[model samples]
Target chain A: MRILVVDDMVTMRKIIKTQLTKLGYTDITEADDGTTAVEAIKIAVSSGQPYDLIISDWNMPNMSGLDLLKAIKSTAEIANTPFLMVTAEAEQKSIIEAIKSGVSNYIVKPFTPDTLQEKIKKIIPNPVK
Target chain B: MPIKVPKTLHPFINAVEKTFKILCFLDVTPGDPIIKNHKVSDKSISGIVGMVGSKYIGSFVISFTAECILNIVQKMLGEKYTEVNDAVSDTVAEITNIVFGNAKKELADMNITLEMAIPYTIRGNNHIITHKTDGPYVVIPFSSSLGTFTIEMGMEPKKKDRRG
Candidate 1:
């Protein structure tokens, strides 16, 4: 499965990539911010290999994950793709906004790989094992 | 004017412990806290974040010796890091962001609501930190098998109370 991980912090991107790799995922790509993530998603869709999943951080410099989620959901082609928000913003308001915006799952940062695996499974019943 | 510190700093303390345990897979014990003027040594790095609320305003800081940070990052990423680099700095900022986020939730339970802000990373020998509040930066030190680090929190109630 092709997965896109978006986070402004390089360390966080690496960590998420590492965790996804450990979960038997090899086709992973990364974007530093929401703007770049949007470009990547569009390019991937045009190339006929749209991402299977998008995991993004909530707070970013260019565009926030919530904005990115809204953008994706509004676009007909990529709207169906499952989105998982990984963030440090655990506020009820933030979570509610993400849910209202159509995030498949939300996980707070500093989470374990087991927790990630569980969340991923909920979104993708048989994520590329 | 005397600055009134918050009644509890357990949120930040608990957040740091949980972050280290889950993210780095290392157990950490917080040392006794000190008020104001904690010494940051040479070759140290810190991640600073400003927080604001209806009732108060302040900042949260996490400081580490370069050696300690390098060791922790190496352990976290399963790679060898001899010196602090962009990667190391990014780790510190993200860790601070997570800790602050966690702490904000707990603080909210105590009727303290903090707005989120991105963290900043400063690295050098004895870099200075300026918090939002005027007085009383509470510094809590933590020790792990890798090394030692400190977290400083300072918040003073706003001059005029406003309900959110």
Candidate 2:
């Protein structure tokens, strides 16, 4: 499955990529910031090569992951894509906002690979199915 | 006078311990807290987060030596970094963000609303970090296989002549 990982930090991006690879997902793309992620998402939809999953960092330099989620959910074309928020912000209010914004799942930072797998399973149960 | 140690400090400690364990695969626990040393910059790389809460208003800092921090980045990226670079600096900031974010959530449950500022980083060898706080800050030391660093908190930053 095609996936997009968004984070300004290369370390975090690499960690997530490693965990995803361990889960047998190698078709992954990455964007450093939310604005670039938006552009990439729009292009993917246009080419009919839509990403099956999107894992984004909550805070970023340009657009934030929350805004990107809102933008994605508002557009009918990419609204249904499974979106997960990977962030260090564990505030209840922020979490509520993401839930309200149609985030499929949320993974707080400093999480173990098992926990990451659990959240992804919650989003895509049986990707092969 | 020394401010009474706030009960909120426990959650902050827990946050740091847990974050290091999960992210760097290191087991970190609190060492004896040093009541002295007003400056927060006690290591090579330090990341600080400012907080404004109802009952507490101050900033928290995490300071690590170059060896400790570089080891962490290497573990996270599955690569080696010999010297301090932008990537190492940014990773340290991200770690600070995660530790602070975890603590902020726990503290919020206690009715202490803390607004977090984007983390700032300081890099140097044996440099002093100055933040003027309203009260004497509490310095809690922690040790891991990588090295030892301190987590400091206070009411306000140092007024003038802030260095590293």
C-alpha TM-scores of all predictions: 0.94, 0.90
TM-score chain B for all models.
0.89, 0.84
Cα RMSD, model 1: 2.9
**Top-lDDT structure, candidate number:** 1
Instruction: Residues B1-164, candidate 1: write the lDDT tens digits.
Output: 43433465898888989998898888999877677754343448999999988888888999998778988898888777888888889899999999999999988889899888999989888787867877667777788899989888878778786435
- Report the Cα lDDT for residue B161, model 1: 67
Cα RMSD to the true fold for all candidates: 2.9, 4.5
Q: In model 1, how many backbone clashes occur?
A: 0
- Candidate 1 lDDT, A27-71, residue by residue in tens: 999999898888899999999999999999998876999999999
Tell me the deviation in Å of residue A24 in model 2.
1.2
lDDT of 1 at B159: 70
Q: After superposition, how far is residue A60 of candidate 1 from its true place, in Å?
A: 0.9
Give lDDT tens digits, candidate 2, residues A1-129. 889999987778888999888878889999998889888988999999999999999877668889999999998988998999987878878999999999999999888888988998899887741
Off by over 4 Å in 1: B1-6, B38-43, B162-164
- Per-residue lDDT tens digits for candidate 2, residues B110-140, read 7777876678788887665655355467788
Scanning candidate 2 chain A in windows of ten residues, the lowest lDDT window is A120-129
